[model samples]
Target: MEATQILDVARDGILTMVIIAAPVLLAGLTVGLIISLFQTLTQIQEMTLVFVPKIIIVYMAVLILLPFMIQQLVELTERLMDLAISLP
Candidate 1:
């Protein structure tokens, strides 16, 4: 592949990765922040307090987003295959 085509593919790959990961990451961040705020307000400074909820929420978020993530990955894979087939 030409340098420009390679760069384009790399950029697209990175963008797709970010798009796929954003929701779960955001869910974790939001849950963590809210838990932190609650801890601060209630003065409950248990170290393990944050883990369970974050895990559960992140898991739920991943489950909910799984279908969309799979679709995106499939589309990306198909596009990559098409590009490979079209190459010299």
Candidate 2:
């Protein structure tokens, strides 16, 4: 592959990864922030309190987003394969 083509593929892969991960990451961040706020207000600083809800919410977000993530990955793979087949 040409340098530009390689770079394009890499960029696309990274972008796809970030797009796929964003929902779960954002959900985790939101849950953590809310828990932190609650802890601050209540003067409760249990570490598990912060971790458990974030993990559950992020897992739920991942489950909800799994289909879309799979579609994006399949599309990216198909495009890369097509590019490879067309390459000299």
Best by TM-score: 1
What lDDT does candidate 2 reach at residue 55?
80
Model 1: residues with Cα > 4 Å off, grouped in runs: none
Per-residue lDDT of 1-88 in model 2, one digit per residue for the tens? Answer: 8999999999999999999998889999999999999999999978889888888898899899999999999999999999999999
Error of 1 at 84 (Å): 0.4
Root mean square deviation (Cα) for candidate 1:
0.6
The C-alpha local distance difference test score for the whole of candidate 2 amounts to 0.93
lDDT of 1 by residue, 1-88 (tens): 9999999889889989999999999999999999999999999999999999999999999999999999999988998999999998
lDDT on C-alpha atoms for all candidate structures: 0.95, 0.93
Pairs with steric clashes in candidate 2: none
